[model samples]
Structures are given as structure tokens and as C-alpha cells.
Target chain A: MAGTWIFVEQRDGNIRKVTYEMLSEAKKFGDEVAAVVFGKGVEALAPEFAKYGADKVYVVEDDVFANYNTGAYVAQMVAMINEFKPNAVLFAHTFNGRDFGSRLAQKLQLGLATDAIAVELSAGKGLFTRAIYAGKALAKVEVAGEPVLGTIRPGVCEVGDVSGAGAVVKPAVAATAADVYQTVKSFVPTVSARPELTEADVVVSGGRGCKGPDGIKLVEQLADLLGAAVGGSRASIDSGWLGHELQVGQTGKVVNPNLYVAAGISGAIQHLAGMSSSKFIAAINTDTEAPIFNVSDFGVVADLFKVIPTLVSELKK
Target chain B: MKVLVCVKQTFDTEAKIELKDGKIADAGINLIINPYDEVAVEGAIQLKEKGVAKEIVVVAAGSDKAMDAIRTALAMGADRGVLVQQDTAADEFARAVALADAIKAENPDIVLAGHVAADDGSSQVPTRVAEILGFPHINVITSIEVAGGKATCSSEADGGTQVTEVSLPAVISSQVSWNEPRYPSMKGIMAAKKKPVATVAAAAADNKVKIVEFSMPPAKAAGIKIEDEPEVCATKLAEWMKNTVKVELK
Candidate 1:
């Protein structure tokens, strides 16, 4: 019988939404779904996994996993995989997931497909589809090795109905301090109530046309009114108008939100690669020739400084 | 400190990709060192200049043409180059194994690589190599400082920055913000010719994954355009977003 394992990612004791997203996707592979969580005080989050379709939750609670270290996490995951021998392992394509999952796949010599947008069972094996050339093309990949590993791109799959058995178990393997060679000195979190850009339901992004940081403020206000996450194009980030973490483009974060709004941004191909998969796109730019209008569901030719305030006010009413 | 930088040759970022018969058509296309990898090479050069690194070696796993990319790194001031001869079809796992094998022989103090290859965007090979070598790995590092045999760096995370310190012999993937890569000058180009580039046979390994097919994304339909006063445009956009896009507006 085939078994599927999903890495349940958590931070500061709260579970991330992508874990459930992966669980929902894992259920479709016709395998016994398991969720593996590694962290201190994460056992309480097991019931939440059950709601998302986990047949069993494997909790590796230890102080050694309190902080996210690639070496320690990979060691623990490798140990768990060796014991369980799951046919497939799923992870969210987040920073930590990419770090540890890729390493685990390498240490075990397993077939790994990263940033997969779609996963399905074909011919009794898993087929993963990923984007290449900045979302211009899709490549379907099939894993030939046992225990195939994949990292699912966040916001691509939907959360399925809750109908799991809610069973939870503790894994025997434990991570030791010696397993870690790196130490996290500090975490400086961005103080924002807005949802993370990658997982946001809506994203509002500005480009060079924002003119300066002040103009980006206007974009932020519009995003706030719409309850959306704020992002910037490569031009804006390169100009220091925004932080690199907020950049959305080929070299930046890929977002597949339900709605995306672009203001004063001429959609470069690189920028389009990151947000083209969004369910709905709205573009606002003064230049009618801007390529962003080509993919937008709705387009407006206007000055963003004037348009943003108007949108914010209109939404207020 | 001995530092090894892994680089890849990829199409220029601005190159318009064309596919023919389910593969990228490369004729007449310009190839450059993967931009992020260039940043890594630059970082190593900076470290060497700062007297923190004693030597820098660049490595790549690709066909013979990858030497051009290595030469570019050597021009940027890497000491030597190693090319692991392999077919372009090798998957990330196989590439990592080959690279680990090459890297293990050097026994360097550190390994540097691009956060992700511009072509495939896998972001896997370096991390996999670190795992195979049992070394600590960090990705998307913005700044790195080596002192007292430990490297402390700030890396980008989901909602913020993470300040981390890893022991020597760690693998770090360079972010674009790490450092600006220097351009190869005429003098540097001449010197690069004298740099040694050793080609090594790559050990064959089983590929875990196979690309079944490749196809272009569907064309997007033309959108509705609105040209009106700012107020009118805002009202219309809000209406479309609510009625058509059906987004929940707070």
C-alpha cells in the first residue's frame, strides 16, 4: 500500500496555511496520508491536520527543533522517512521547506520536484507539473525513484473538506543538538498585519511608475483598503523603494493569489512570470502600451497617484 | 579559507525563450553565467580581497561550453575551475551527487552558489550537495561575515529577515542583494586564459525524475479596457472587482 507524507510547517507554535494545502493535495494520490510535524509543542496542532485529511499525524516534539536549522531538520526528516518508508513526501514550497526538503532528498538520493504547481496520480505514480521560463511554459515530471519528494507551491491547491480520522502518533526518532551546525541568532519579523504576499488571497503591487517611496505609500493604502498584501516589481525593489522580500518577479517570490492588482507597473515578462498564475488580475497604468494590460482581467489607463486615492475612497464608501 | 563557488551557464535573463519540439531552442540565443551565480563569484572575490579567503575555485556541471562561464568567473578573480562533464539532461539529484563528489575532493572551508538557477529555478542542487556532504546549508543570503571560523549572515524568510551563524565548511546561496558582481575587464579577460580549468568525468547516477513533456502556457484573453476620469476609473474597477472577480472587499 502506498503511503503519502506531508510536512506540517509551523512557526512560533502556530501552523501555517500551506501545510493544510499540501494535505488536501496529498489525499488525491490514493495513498494513506500522514502529516509529519517537527517542533516543540506542536502535538496540539495534530487535530488541525486531521481536519485537513491526515490519516495519521507524526509529531517529533523536541527542544532541538525549536528553531529552524537545515541540518537538524534534514537529519530528523531522514530518520523519519527511513522508518516510515513512505512512497511520497510532500512539503510546502516555503523557505524552510525548500531548504530542508531539498537536502533530505539529496541525502536519501530520492527524486525531488520543487515548486510544483500541480500534483496528480497517473499510471499509479505521482506526476508533478512545474513552471519554467518564468511561467511561460509548464513541464510535467514523473519520479522514477521510490519515496519521491515534492514541494507544492502555495496558493495553487485548494483546501479540501475535513473528513480525517484524527489519529496522532509520536515518532521514535529525535533530533540532537549535535545534528545542527548552524544557529539562528535572531528573527526580525516584519511588523505587518497584512497577509504574507505568497499566501495572500489578493496582492497589490507597484512598479517604477510609483515614482518614489511616497508613491508606494499610495499603493500600500489601496492594498490596505482592499485587505490585500502589498508587493513591488523588480524596478521598485532595485531602486530601493521596497524591500527585497516584497519583490514579485522572476528572481523574486512567485504569488498565485485569487486577485492581483498592478499599479503603475508595466508588466515585464519577468514580473508576469511570478503573478501570471493569479486567478484574476487588474492593471492600472498611464501608458496604454504597457504589456501588463495584456494579461489583466480589467485595465485602466490613468495616473496611479490619482487613481489609488480614488480607489481607496471609493472602497471606503 | 578555501572557498568554492558553483556556477551554471544559462540563457540571458532578457532572452526571449522559444520552444521547438518540446525543448528550448538555443540557436542564436545568448548565454551568460547565471546572474545569481555571478553574484556568488563576486562575493568570493570580495572575501578574498578582504583577506578572509585564501583561494577561490569555481565549479560547474555541464557540457564543454560551461568552460566559458568558468572562464568568466576566473576573470572575476577565482583561482581555478573544475568542470564535471555531464549531459544537460541530468536531473538535479544527479547533478548534486556529481557536484558533491567534486566538492569533497577540494575539502574547502566554504561553498557558495546561486540561490536558484535562472533557467530551471530548481534551487535544489546546492542544498542537496550540502546534505550529501553533511555540511550546514543556508539559502538566499543577503550579507555574510566570516569571523573566528564562523560565518554569520542575514537571509530572507517568509515575513522577515533571519540572522544566522553557521560553522566553517557551510554552503551559502547568494541573493541578488549580496554584492554587485564586477564586470570582466580586458586585462582580467587576458589573465583568465592562463587560469587552469580541469575537466573531470562525472559518476553516473540514476535520475529520480524525468521530464515527460513541455508545452507553452495558454494565451491570455484580451481584457476589458477602461479610459475615464480617475474617479470614474476607480468606481468602475471596484465594481468589476466585486462583481466579476468576486473578491471580498473589506
Candidate 2:
């Protein structure tokens, strides 16, 4: 009687890409997958979840849930889990997920696994794999709780290939006013040309070798041509030449893209810990001695200025 | 106004870390205040210097050896330091619980901490601390302005920036943009010896998460040279993309 649950994260009543990825993976285990979404007028987004392989969509329309409230979201999730009695739950390893997951795990007295890159059905249950040590290693996490909870890194799992197969929208039986302790006054979205870092398939990151903020233009141009997300090393971010969201290092965003292009980055161990998991790495650096070259699938020792422009032009052709 | 900043001691990011029997090796590795936490400390001091806050308190969780780090912060202008002795690995949830308990005791107008520890790369602690305290929280915050029991913070999000206002007593994770943290002066280091530090034993942590074991990554094969000339390098890259890696060009 244990079913799989996916928290359908939404903003302005629209489904995010991560929601689809979670449901898509959940269906592989042949578990009865359900998505929990909270917001007024969000029932419209339920079918979208279905298209991505959810069995049922749990819609909780409440004004209090309009914006993200740290206290209320955690309380609602904790209560919903107790009511649903799920065997496993998957969440998008996002800011909100990071904020709420651990607390829910604690209240339920269940172990929480975070930022997992992949989850698979093993034996009768599921096993989650996550990148650890700043992306230097992979760790397979086994949860001790009867019901396992994991936050999946976005973009790691593919979108649903089987379309229009999921079930109809249903009201979440567990959502209650008692668990709502906080209210959201407003909700703001990040304004970027590309998708979320973890959700992006291709990431182009720059390092101190970019010279200054203006140097990001070259990286951005290439990313734009490839329709990829842009990232930076900790040094570039710390130097105020790039935004923190674009940093890919030990303390920065952990990304596992199909392709990662690092330009001008020397590839410090900390920096490598973030993007080393990337399936394909292409490094562009003037210094052939840069450590980043050691792990790169392809190394271009020439100036990124000369190499990137040429690559971009060739790709455009 | 009063602000509390949580500081931590971490191996310098530049240092090579070795795992010894599932734990970090205690080699001759030099320990420094986590750079992000140093930003938090600097932010707290800047607030105090601006006369926006009457006092700033710095808290840390570690062994007795961490007293030196606390003293370093005190010399940088933190009014007092609190040390929580715990043997637990500096994981996110555990540190959040301990920091939350300590912050509650102080009852500061705002609580500050780094978004993540550099070593673990788990950016869950600050937001977790915010949840445990039941406060509105913001991450990657660069600037903070307080007035009338409300603080407006500018957060660097996915693409652009977000300007948000939360009431006092909120939690914020400091970003590198907070300010250029000042270097500890010789005078400050000397004055730190006179500052007081209170160490308390933390309650037994209910460690829910467990690491099965730690292992290093497989050694990368030696990199192949992309030939000598620029055009040849480009050709070689193209050939590798088409033949070996089989990456299709758009």
C-alpha cells in the first residue's frame, strides 16, 4: 500500500521542469506515483504533471500557500507525508526543496538524502546516488526510514517519454489548515535567459582567466549559441565578476550536465569538485599547465578568446 | 539592534583534503575561517560600525581547538563569541539545529551564517537554520538594509537579482557580495587575546543521516594533446567530437 510521492513545485500556478523529471523517474519503479501541489488555481497545472508520467496529482488550493513560507511549507509537507503513508518521496533539489526536505525528514524521524543525481529500483525498494566531496566522488545513499525521502538533482533524469499516460487530478486528502503556520505575501522569479543551473543540459562556465566581468560576454555568447546555462568558478564569483548563481565549485552550485565547457578556469580541486561529474568536459585555457586540463575530455591550451569565438562561429555555421 | 553571526573553521579551499578511514585526515592542513563565514562576520561588523546595531555576537560549533577561530573573529570586531563543542561532522542539519538553539538564546534581531561549508559543499545549512527558527530567510544575499523592524535584502538568484523585505529577526545567508572582509590586523590579533569566549557542550546530536563510506574518484587518464597549431587543434577537436566522442554539431 506504499505509493511514491513527488512534490509538484509551482510558481504562479505553473509546473516546473523538475516536477516532470521526478515523476518520470518515479514511474520506472512501477510505484503508484502522486504529485502534491499547493496553490489556488493550480489545478490547471495538474494535467501537465500527467503528461510527464504522474499517476495522480494532489491539488491543494489555499491562499496561504500562494508564496513560499519556510514554516508553513515544511509543516504542510510533514503533515501530508503522515497522511499519505508513502513508501518513498522524491523532491526537486531546489532552493525550496533544500529548505523544506531536511525538516520534514526530521519531523517524520526519517533519514533524508539530498541532491541525488539518480535513483533506481533495487530489490524491492529504491537506492539513490548523489555526488559528494564537492563532486569529487559519488555516494550511494541508503535511507534507514521505512519510507525513504530523497531530493533529486534537477536535469539528471529525463522528461517523460510516454505522453498522456498519467491519471486525473485529485484533491490531496491530507492538506489541512492546522499545518499552515506561515503565509506568503509575494513570489518572485529569477530572471535568466537559460533554465535553472541543475536543470540545464549544457553548461558553459568561466573562471578567473576571463579577466573581468566583461569577459563573461564570450562565455555567454557561446552558451547562448548552444542554448546552455552559464556558470563560473568560485574565484570569478568571489572576485565580483560573476553572480553567485553562476558559480560551479565546492561551495557553489553542483551541476551534472551532458556537456560542461570550462573557459579560463585553472580547475582547482574545489572547482573540479563541482563540475567533474559532467559527462563530457571541454576545457579552454591559455595556460596548458592549468589543473583543469588533467580531467578534461578535450583540452584546448590556446587562448579562450581565440578558441571560443572560432568554436562559436563554426557551431553557428 | 543586535545581530548574531555563525562562523566555522574549515580547511582552506586550496588545501588538498585526504579522507582517512571515512573521515577527513588531520594532516598538517591549515585551518582558516570559512571564507563565506568571514563574509558573514564582516557584514555583522559593518552593521555595528554603521551604528545600525548595538552589538554583534559570533558563534561557532567545533572542538576546543576552534577557540582560536572565534578569537580571530572577535579581533575583527565581534563583541563576544560562543563556542559549542561537538564531535559530530559539520553536516548541515546538525549544525543548523545547534546554531538555531544558540541563536534563540541570544535573541538577536538578525541571524547570519554562510550558505554552505566549503568542504562538504552542502548548501543546506543556512536555509535549514532558517526553517528550524521559523523565520523568513534569503540566500546569496549581497546587501542588507534595516529600518522599522524590517530588513530589505538583495539576493542574487538564477539570472538577475531579487529585492525582498522581511521583518526583523529573519535569517540570511551571506554572499561574497556582502563586502570585502577586512584582513585581521596585528592590533586586532593582539586585542583578541583579551576577548572572552564561552564554551558549552552541545547536546547529543540525533544524527539521522549516515555516510556508508568515503572513496576518492578514479584517477583521470592523462589528457591527450590537441596537436600544436590553432587550426590543427580545432581540427583535432572536431575530429574527436565527430569520431571518438561522437558529439553531433548543430
Candidate 3:
């Protein structure tokens, strides 16, 4: 029972890619790596977890899990943790995951590290590293005399394929649904054909220099051309030119993409903290002294409006 | 309805980090209300202005300096304030316990806090308080409306927004830009001085997550800047992206 458990997050019955990444990483740190998934119509996904090295897939299928509810999910997870008594329980650092992860830790009276970018095995315990000061510094975290519980940040771990024969285990959850305290009024899923901002390899963004919504459209065109995601600086978001979901900053979504192209954004410390970890950065702005150039691998100090079309056409080369 | 807003004082988002003896140097640093917590305060003020909320009580746990933030929130429209005196060195678990105890004494109808602390980046305290109080929580919320003893909230979720309704005595954490925070006018600032802010000792709670040390990330190297014509720059950039970066450009 002292194995590792990774909470699998799913949307529309499709397993989020981050789950596979976490499961694959968990294999190296635990004797047995298992994935616990809660949702309706997810039994077919148990086999998919095996490909990522999960020895067993713990499935909790019910109508109450049709969508994420804090009360319903936390109650079931507490029961499972108590029954299995796993040494390590990892959760994806998504919205729902972060919300309930702390709750579970409190209910179980365990210690937890939030948004850990890396984890290692320390005497069969977890050594978690997370960012603090809005990514200005790194904090090495250890929960003293407690089981390792943490929310794993996305885009850091490598995906592994141990090829374990996925054994599906539908553990009997003694927790009843009567404790649920929420009612879903409506769930308007954001419908966008573009790749998700966090998972996309390329993310093109604009800032205050975009001046208005029209400039962001050009940035979107470039993102669409590259099959990338569109994002904006806090300045652009504050102007109401873009939705909060598309904001990339300390207070918004932290993205670690392969290529991040920033147009017109004078890289503030807040904006850089979110995308500074990007593998390769390119910036286009008129100011040669712009801070964005410090982190960019490539820089073009020219008018973004003048350069975007030419860059688009040249990429068409 | 009684509203409780949990606030935290953090370094100004624009402040430069300086480490002395492996700890952040607080001297000469400008401290302000966390931008996200300010959003929570603003959300509460809006609810009161709409006639939906009757009174708002702001609370914080820290050294006496935190009283400044509580005063700021009061000026913005909190009815009264409570300061739970404690060293801020404690982890989210300890902080949540202290805040929850203070909250229990009041037994508010609703609780609001920032989704995450701007300093530790731990998005835990608010939801942890929700658990300690046995209240349902909806976090990372962009908008929240309360009526008929229920809170309707729009939260930012994985793929999109999820609108949920939780009964009274629930927890809600506000996201940045949910609403523009108001400045403390001179008149409001004067009023805040007259407002009663009580101080209470924090109940002892254990520190679960201890930080071994803090180190600044390595500074990025200076990069090459091409200030040539648009056409030439574009051509060179496209070559670098394809050949150097190896990004598959469609």
C-alpha cells in the first residue's frame, strides 16, 4: 500500500496529456505507480494509462463525477487515500486539482507542496521543488514526518513508456454522494480549435503596444499560422483586449512552451516570470532597451506591424 | 449578508528582489496588498454597493505591518477589520488554521480570498479554510453573484469556464482583474482610522512545508538584436526559427 498514486484529470472523457506525463514520472519514485481517475464514461481510458507505465488504474465511475465538484471529489479521494494508504499522492496542478488537493491534505491531516515543478525520492520520501516570489526564486520543500502529497505542475516531466499491463481496479468508495454541496448551473466549455496555451509548443503574444484589439488579431493570425496558441501581457488583458484565460503573467497562466514569440510586449518582470522558462524565446519590439531581449534567443527591433506580414510570408517559405 | 475577506500583504509586484543571508531583504521594500487579494476586496465592495451584502469584515494574519493592508481594504469599503497577530513564517497549513479560527468566531455567511498568494504562490489557504469550516469552495473565479442564500460563481477551469452554485457559508477565491480595485480616497482613509480594527493572537499551528533555502534563478544571457529592414529581419528570423530553433513552422 506504500505505492505512488497519480490523480488523472480528464475533460470530455479524454485524458489530459499531463496525466500521462505525471504517471510516467511517478514510476521512477515508487514501487508501484497507480493512476486514480474519477469521471463518467472513463473506464475505457484505463488501458491508456498502462501505456504510460501505470501498474494499476483505480477507477471511480459514477454520475456524481460527471463533472468536477469539490465536495463530491474530495470526499471520495479521502476514502481512497485512507483505504490504500499510499506513500505518495500526486495531483495535476490544474484548476480543479489545486482546489481539492489542499482540501484533501487538510482532511487527511497530511502535508502538501503546491505546484511542485520537480520531485525526487528521498529515503523513500518526496523532495519537492516549487517556485516562490512569483518565480523569482526557487523553494525546496519537505513535509516533515508526513506522506508526500503534492500538485505536480505541467510541462516539466518527461513522458515514459514502461509498457505495464494496465490492471483496472474499481475500488469500492465508501463515501456517499449525499455530502455534495454544489449544483452545476451551466458549464460553458471554451471551444477553440487552437492548441491549449499551456500544452502548445508555440505561443504568440502581444502587449500594450498592441494599442487595441486589432493588433491582437494580427498576433492571432501568426499564432494560427504556426498552429500555436494566442496569449497576451497583463497590460493587454487589463485593457480588456483579451480574456483572462489568454493572459500570461505572474497572476495569470504560467506557460512553458517550446517557442514563445512576444510582439510589442516590453517584458515586465511579472510577464517574464510566466514564460521565462520557455525553451526558446523571440521578441519583436521597437525599443532596443526592452527587457524582453535579455531572455529572447532571437530579437528583431523593428515595428511589429511592419515585420509580422513579412515574417508570415517568409515562414511560408 | 456578512462577508469575510482574507487579505495578505506581499511585496509590491514591481519590487526588485534582494537576498541578504539567504533571506529576502525587507528593508526599504514597498509592501502592498497582494494584487489578487485586492481583487477580492474589490469584489466584496461591489457586492455591498449592489445592496446584496450587508457588511464586510476583512482579516489578515501577520506582523503589525499587516494592519496597513487591512486599513487599505477598510478604506476601500470593508466595514471593520481583524488582525490576527502572528509571524508570517508559517506555511499555508498554519496560516489557514489561524485564519479559520478567527473566521469561526465570526461565523460569516460567505468567505472570499485571493486564489493564490502573490508571495508564496501557494493557492491553498482559502480552500484549506473551506475544508476546515466544512464549506464548499469555488476558486480561480472571475465573477461571483450571490442571492437567495446561494452563490453563483464563474470559475476558470481546465478547458473553459464552469459556473457553479454553492449554498450559504461557502468559500470563493477571486482572480485578478475580476474588477478594478478602488484607490483609498482621503475621505475614506480618514474613515478607516475611525473604523475599529481588533487584534487577536493566532492559535498555534505547525509549519508543514519548510523551505530549505531561496535562490534567484540564473539570469538570462544577453541576446542578439537585429535592427535591419523588416524584410531582411523577417528572412533571418525565419531561417533561425527553422534551422536553429528547429520549430516546425507551417
Candidate 4:
């Protein structure tokens, strides 16, 4: 019987937190779960994956694997799947994962489900559930064949700790010419000190009601005080108050943080779809009738200009 | 220069979505163009203004009923529109494949789509189309530039933004923040009638995926307790985090 495989995505030399979450989620479905790590800093991540319930870790460490090249990564994934069959493959629902997961599924003639919110084993196979139509609808999908691939949304699966012994298995397949199809001369990452919006456990977002960019800066201050990432509605981004990087909407980023604090956002349906899955939501708006309050777990009926400073000061303490 | 942008129609976000008999109820909901495609259209139009692309063609694969969305794109400054008419119940992958075939036949210089349909948000359509067309593809592109037969796309990734350069005849899935799509002006709305929109039979697609059932998400628990004072509210929230959710903040 094939075991579950989790693709551990890393950048530079740090193991992303989502890898651990995927391992934690994988352990629930299969008796033996393994990890496939492609990049330079993977050796250090093996122990972390094991601490998160990985039975074995597949390490493909090479200079070529250091930077993300879609053609090469998808080729490597196909080769790995062909060699060591797995019942399912899980990936973080990131840009790289979204690029590779769908291509890998299409190449392998398999089904892929993206942004999975929940996963389980049913009737001797793996099953995944995800939201669709923005957050309007939920769909459950069952992957019937071997190597069922799924890319899970960040913050959806709880990161669990399973401190135990883990074995680091050297890459079973070596990188070949075909594995390095695309070449990258250099990579320049974004220069932002804030945590990524999708990965952040807490998010503070502003909307059209913020009045302008200065108000968004206030929202950013509150986010920083609370150790949260900054996010914005489509309107805020369109108004040039926030950079595109800070946008959270159906077509923007899907963030399911522990705490989602919305200020001056009326909670358009499109905006709510991206953040409704958050564990706890708090909306502060001057308009008591704003739609954001409908889905918010907690709401404050006061002008954000007044309430935000008080909240920020209190949280800073 | 020729550009192709894929568009889809989805329910407005605030529409009360209801599932009836294991399928999405077809309420008389107000339909708007998928927000992502609006970004794509905006990008295409911007390219036109830069003199890099002259003609923009918007295409969609759906039932005959989808002609309305095609008209909507025509109103948005597309030089022309094409509808790959198909029956209802078409899966996303199949629609993308068919649309890809149609686009390939047209041989546009750049093909762009909204990153994903808001209704489904599967985000697989463009990648599938790219694979089928054997062209370089990028997702979540916030910025773009075409020079010397190559396109440079800047996309938002998990921790940071990423940049990639691909040759022309590539596929790009646009994000909502890519550009502010222009609203139809009175002049453009009036000129929309002059644009030519063609309809053709959809190419055959082997759809392997199926939607068994769809349901609204589970309701959130009862109202959250908030203290009148901000300090008291924070304390209560902290208590709930520790006791109810078991998440202890440092």
C-alpha cells in the first residue's frame, strides 16, 4: 500500500511553517507519511518534519533546486511519484504549489484539489474538502487513484506536534538534465519586514472606508503591534492605499488567520470570500449596517478612527 | 499585436447563495463579470495603450446562455469577442481546454485570464490551458511588460514577490490587484454595438472531474462576547483564545 507524501516547500535556508502543517495533516490519513524536500536547505528541515509526524523525509538538495523553476520542479515531482508511489501528495496552497500541483496532476492524469480546508480518509482512500465560488460554497472531493494530489490553504490545518524519531532518506532520484529545464539567472525577493499575509496567524485589513492611504498606515501600526500581517480589501488596493501585495480577496490572496481584524471595511461578498474562513473575525466600522458585521465573530460599533487607536494601544500593552 | 483575455460570469459577492438538491440554486442573482477577468481585460487594454498590442479579443466557453458575458466584454473595449458555445454542466478544466484550443487557433500574442473564477477559485484553468498550449505560464501576476518578444511578469508569492521572464505567446493568470479595470464609459458603451462578436462550436474536451455536491459552509457559533471597554474586550478575547480555542499567545 502506498503511503502519504508531503511536499516540503522551502526558500533560502528556512523551512516554511506550512510544511509542518501539511505533515501534521498527512499523518491523519496514512499510517506512514513521508516528505519530499527539493532545495538546498532541506537537510535541516528533515528533523522538523519528523517532529511534525513525518516518518521519512526525501531530500533533493542541489544548487539547481535552490531557486524555484516550475518546469524543473514539476519534472522532478513526476519522476519522484513514478518511482515511489504514494496514496496522496499534499502541498501548501502557495503560488509555487499552485503552479506545480495543477501541472503535475495534468501530466500524471490525476485529479487535483486546491485550497483544501479539510482532509480525511474515507472508504479506504483520501478525501479533501475545499471552498469554491469565493467562500460561497463548499465542495468535497475524493481522489480515487494513487498519488492523490492536494494543495491546502494556509492556516486551514492546525499545526500539530508529533515529536518522534524520523529517518532522512537521500533523494531516491538524482537531478538530471530534464529536471533543470528552466534556468534562473538570479532571484530578488520582495523587501518587506512584515510577515506574509497568507502565513500570518493574525491579519489586520482596511477598506474603502479608511478614507485613504494614511488611514491604512494606522491599520498597519495596529497589525505590527499585534504581530499581524497587513491586508486590504479590493477597494483599498484599487484606491492605491495599499500595495497589491496586501490585497485579500477572491482573486487576491486567501488568508485564514487566527484573528482577522477588519477596519472600515463594509465586507463586500468578494472580500469576505477571502477571509471568512479565519478562526476569529473582528470588524470595526462606523457604519453599524456594514455587511462585514454579518460574518464577523465580534464587531465594534464605533468609528475606526477612534476605536483603532484605543485597540492598538491596548494590544501594545 | 493580438491579445486574448478569458472572461467568466459569476454571481455578485453579496448574493445570498443557496444550494438546492445538492446543486447550486439558480436564483435570479445579479451576475457580474468575474473580478479577475476584469484585471486581465485591464492589462490587455494597458498593453494596447503602450502600442505593444493593437487588438484585444475576449473569449469565453460556456453554454449559449453565455453570450451575455461576451457582450459585457465587448462593452469593455475588446476589439471583438468569441463565444465557444457549449451545453450546460461543463467542468472548468474542459472549458479551459476548449478555450485554449480556440485561443491557439486565433494565435494571439499574449493570452491572459483572471487567476481563477471567483465562483470556483480552483485556479487550475490557466495552468491547464498553458500545458495544453505548450506555452510558458505565470499566476498571480501584479505587473507585466512585453519587450523583445519576451514578457516579464511580477507575481505575489507566499513570503515575497517573484519575477519571471517568458517569451511571447505565453499565458498569464491575472490577479485582482494587477490593475484597476476601467469601467465602461458612455462612449464605449455606445460603441460596443459596433464591435463584432463571433460564435463557434466548442471543441471536444475530456472532462475527468465532476462536482458531486455543493453546500453552504457550516454556520459559525453564537455571537462572540465583547466587553464594552477595549481593555476588557482584549482580556475576554485572550481568555477565549486560551480556554475555548486552546491557542495561547506568547
Candidate 3 vs candidate 4, lDDT winner: 3
C-alpha lDDT of residue B48 in model 3: 92
Each model's fraction of native contacts:
0.80, 0.30, 0.82, 0.37
Candidates 1 and 3, the one with greater TM-score: 3
Q: Which runs of model 2 end up more than 4 angstroms from their true locations?
A: A106-110, A120-128, A138-141, A160-165, A172-191, A212-215, A234-241, B90-93, B242-250
Q: Per-residue lDDT tens digits of candidate 4, residues B1-250?
A: 8999998877776676888888888779888888888889889989999999999999988876666777777777888999888765666557766888799889998999988777877888888788778787878888998999888887766666677788778898897768778888888888888888888888887665555567788777655534365545544544543455444233
Candidate 4, residue A40: lDDT: 70
User: Model 3: residues >4 Å from true position, as ranges?
Assistant: none
lDDT of each: 0.87, 0.75, 0.87, 0.78
The 10-residue segment with the lowest total lDDT in model 1 chain B: B241-250
Error of 4 at B231 (Å): 7.6
Query: What's the candidate order when arranged by decreasing lDDT?
Result: 1, 3, 4, 2
Of the two candidates 2 and 4, the one with more favorable lDDT, higher being better, is 4
- Evaluated with TM-score, which candidate comes out highest? 3
DockQ score of the complex predicted as candidate 4: 0.42
TM-score of each: 0.97, 0.89, 0.97, 0.91
For residues A1-317, write the lDDT of model 2, one tens digit per residue: 47788987676765678888888888888778888787778778877877787777777777667765555677666666666677887778776676567657655555677887778653335567767656665666566565677888877787868543456545454445555543333346666767678777788899988998677899898888777889999778878787777788776777888888898999988889888877778888878788999889999887777777677765644
Q: List pairs with backbone clashes in candidate 2.
A: A134-A273
2 versus 3: better TM-score goes to? 3
